[model samples]
Target: MLRVGVVGVGNMGRHHARIYSELSKEGEVEFVGVADANLERAKEVASQFKTKAFGDYRELIGRVDAVSIAVPTSLHKQVALEFIENGVSVLVEKPIAESIESAQEIIRAAKKNNVTLMVGHVERFNPGVLKLKEILDENLIGKVVTLTAKRVGPLPPQIKDVGVIIDLAVHDIDVMSFLLERNVRKVYARAGSAKNPLELEDYAIIMLDFENATGVVETNWLTPHKVRTLSVVGTEGIAELNYITQKLILYNHEWVKEAKVQFKEPLRNELEHFVECVKKEEKPLVNGEEGLHALMVAIKALESANKDEAIDVEFT
Candidate 1:
């Protein structure tokens, strides 16, 4: 069984802990231990799950085969590199690292260690997205012509680690790249801080151009309502995905009306897939390269916003 340790017990980290605990209970993996800077919080989570707790993550590296890192963006490189250097597989929460250079270092370390390095771009596992991908693959959409996404919600101040672009909009950018399966030619964005004092943006609008079409994303933490919506316009039909409800809708002239479908919880599905990958030693759908590509586009968007000019994503 794969021995798993989770570092960080914050909001998203807590979910990772619970999922790891459940995986262990299901006999798919072993719950090695958990670490958090907040000793009390770590102890509490450990006690709840009947696992050991560590104040320092380094202490658990030798004991676990793999680790799920849910720490802040700033600490992603430090934490991931530590475990990766010791030949431990890692599932790091998304945006890979705070910058492209750091992300490259983490990727390099994992490559040198020959350990699995996956990013937690959980939306890639969403059933709705999977079904949409199926339709696209079948040419049911008749070649996607344009794409747009709106990921907005009331401020979750606890997520001050990264800006809305990295924290929220990166999902759509990643999804757009997956859906189109092409290299983006150019990106333009505008963003500003809403409340936080840091340079991190709370509201942003991004645009990406591909060979055949364009994609747009509006992400913000200032919206009054929670909305995770994506609308894809293809030559044949338009598809809408409501991420919050796991519902999908397709509109076409041939249908006479729009068709709608609902799916189960994506988070559970995502975790199940992760467990399967670990058990099978298989490459995950959203691997480090995919995550890095998304980050590259996001960083360009940030640069575009800062310079007030369209920036081209330079692929390495």
Candidate 2:
């Protein structure tokens, strides 16, 4: 069994610890321990998962064969490098790092050490999204023309370091790239701070121009009710997905077809994939470069908004 641990037992980190513990029951992984800056919180999560706890994340380095880095955005590169440089595979949470340079450093370090680095772009594993991809591949949507995603909800208490673009828009940007299999060619965005007490932009409308198709993502924190949805419009039809409900629907001139998808928690699938990648020495579904591309797109969007102009996209 592969020995595993989790660092950062905050809202997202606890879920990672819980999933690792559950993966242990199948005999493929062992939940070694969990660590957090907050010792009491770490102990609390460790107890719930029936494992040991460490106050400092560094303590998990030598003991764990693999680790999940769920710390805040600013801490991603720092925490991830600690485990990766020690020859531990890591599943770092989304957006990889706050800046492109930090992301490049982490990727380079992982390559230097030959360590597996997976990003937690969990939406890629959602049942509905999986179905949507299958449908697109089967030409149900014909040639794609436009893709749009809206992910809005009340401001989450857990997000402090980054605004909605980095926190929420990146998810759809990554999803659009994954679905289209093309890098973004141009980016334009307009954002403003509405209800955010931190004076960071809490709402944004980002437009990405791919080689052939156009993509748009609208995200905000002012919505009273949570919304997570995506749609793809193509030559023949349109596909709609309700992310939370795992529901997909296709609309054509002739009729509308609602897909029947088998539901599985996206986080569970993501962690399982991370474990499989480590054990089999395989590349992840969302590798380091993919993560970096998403971060780059988001950063470009912010820059576009700041300059009040479209930014040409290029990933080196």
Candidate 3:
């Protein structure tokens, strides 16, 4: 059995621990333990999962074959490097790192240690998204011409380190890239901090130009009700995905078809995939390079918003 632990048992991290603990009963994985800077929070979550708790993540370095890092964006690099340096595989939460430099550093460390590195772009595992990809791959949409996503909800109490672009819009940015299978050529964005107490943009519109398609992402923390949706317009028809409900619909001039999808908890799927990768020594779907590319686009959108101009996206 592959041994695993979770670092930072906060909102998302606690769910990670729960899933690992549940999976452990099947004998496929061993839920080792959890670590958090907040000792009480760590202890509480470890108790729920029936595992030990550590005050410092360093305590888990040599004990597990892999770990899921769900600390804040700022501490991602520091925590990820420690585990990677100890030859442990890691699955870090989205945005990879606060900046591209730190993301590169983590990627370099993972490579040097020869460990499996995965990024938790959980949306990729959503049933709707997976079905949408299948339909697109089969040319049901007939060459995507444009894509648009709207993800808006009230401010999350746990988010204090980043703005809407990084925390919210980055999801769509990565999804758009995944669907189109191309890098963003340019980004034009506008953002504001209306109603948000923090000095971060709570509302933003980002436009992305890909080699073959145009995309728009609308994200905000001002909506009273949560909304997570994506629409694709192609030469033949339009496809819509409701992320929350995991529903997909395809529309054409002659007919309308609703896709049938088997929904699974995205987090469980993601973590299971991470374990399979570790056991078989395979590359994860959302690898470090993919995470870095998404981060680059999000950073460029932020720059565009700050400068009030369109910015070119460069990949190194």
Most lDDT-accurate candidate: 3
TM-score of each: 0.95, 0.99, 0.99
- Structure candidate 3, residue pairs in collision: none
Candidate 3 lDDT over residue span 1-316, tens digit each:
8999999999999999999998898888999999999999999999988999999999997789999999999999999999999999999999899999999999999999999999999998898999999999999979899999999999998999999899989899999999999989999999989988887999999999999999999999999999999999999999999999999999999999999989889888899999999999999999999999999999999999999999999986
Q: Which digits, one per residue and each the tens of the lDDT, describe model 2 over residues 89-206?
A: 9999998999999999999999999989999999999989989988988998899999999999999998999999999999999989988999998999999999899989999999
Per-residue lDDT of candidate 1, residues 1-316 (tens digit): 8899999998888888888888889998899999999989999999998899999999898899888899999999999999999988898899899899999999899888888888988888788888888878888778899999999988776787778998888899888889888877899999998775675798999999988889999999888999999999999999988877767778888773333445666656766776677667788888888888898899899999999999988775
Candidate 3: list runs displaced more than 4 Å. none
Error of 1 at 266 (Å): 2.6
Clashing pairs in 2: none
Order the numbered candidates by lDDT, best leading: 3, 2, 1
- lDDT of the structure predicted as candidate 1: 0.87
RMSD of each: 1.6, 0.7, 0.7
- Name every residue pair that clashes in candidate 1: none
Two-way TM-score contest, 1 vs 2, winner: 2
